[model samples]
Target: MNGRKNVVEVLIFKKEVEADPRFNVIGEVSLEDTDMLDHIGEGIDVKLIPI
Candidate 1:
């Protein structure tokens, strides 16, 4: 692979998921994250399936 941007699709189970009601600021601020990790990795608990 060359030094280029690569896109990887990840599959996460809906079971192991938790979210904070207060940290939901995605709609409030699009693109940039006023929170940490764009609120995607932050304020959320999830596990990716190991390939």
Candidate 2:
């Protein structure tokens, strides 16, 4: 993180885990929201908000 621009990625985990820098896990989604993961495709529009 030495002045590098941050990157965001989406991962579908079959197991739960604590955040790890090696995996770049900034956060996670709820179980109910997992359904949306199946719909990701070429035109996906994503936005990140720092709540």
Candidate 3:
């Protein structure tokens, strides 16, 4: 992080998955809010803020 501040920003869309400690999951997105996943492989700037 090099002296930078760490923050957690989240965006919810519409799909859901189980969360486990094996992965560094900062939080959970609701099943009804997984639509944001569709943008995963596309090169785009996504800023997430929880609603």
Candidate 4:
């Protein structure tokens, strides 16, 4: 339990595949309050990395 990570839900869609896939991505992401604001201002795209 000490080393376990949390899980997050993400939607993945492939053009070839008619239906989207719902998957779980596990990890932690750290964003400071100010950094989050900056990301919004800069229009940064964030996606989950499979682990």
Give all candidate RMSDs, comma-separated.
13.7, 6.1, 5.5, 11.8
Residue pairs that clash (backbone atoms under 3 angstroms), model 2:
none
Tens-place lDDT digits, model 1, residues 1-51: 688976544332223346657444222222343343443553356443433
Residue 4, candidate 2: Cα error in Å is: 17
Give one digit per residue, the lDDT tens place, for model 3 in 1-51.
599877554443244556656556556666676675776653555665667
The parts of candidate 3 lying over 4 Å away from their true place are 1-23
Best by TM-score: 2
Q: lDDT score of model 4? A: 0.42
Superposed by TM-score, candidate 3 places the C-alpha of residue 20 at a distance from the truth, in angstroms, of 8.1
CA shift of 33, model 2, Å:
0.2
> lDDT at 35 for candidate 1?
42
TM-score of 3: 0.37
Instruction: Report clashes for each candidate as comma-separated counts.
Output: 0, 0, 7, 0
- What local lDDT score does residue 17 receive in model 4, on the 0 to 100 scale? 44
Q: Which candidate leads in lDDT?
A: 2
Model 4, residue 10: displacement in angstroms?
1.1
Q: Write the per-residue lDDT of candidate 2 for residues 1-51, one digit (tens) a residue.
A: 589977655655646778777776666777787787677665576665665
Model 4, 1-51: lDDT tens per residue? 799877544432211344325534343344343344344423345564564
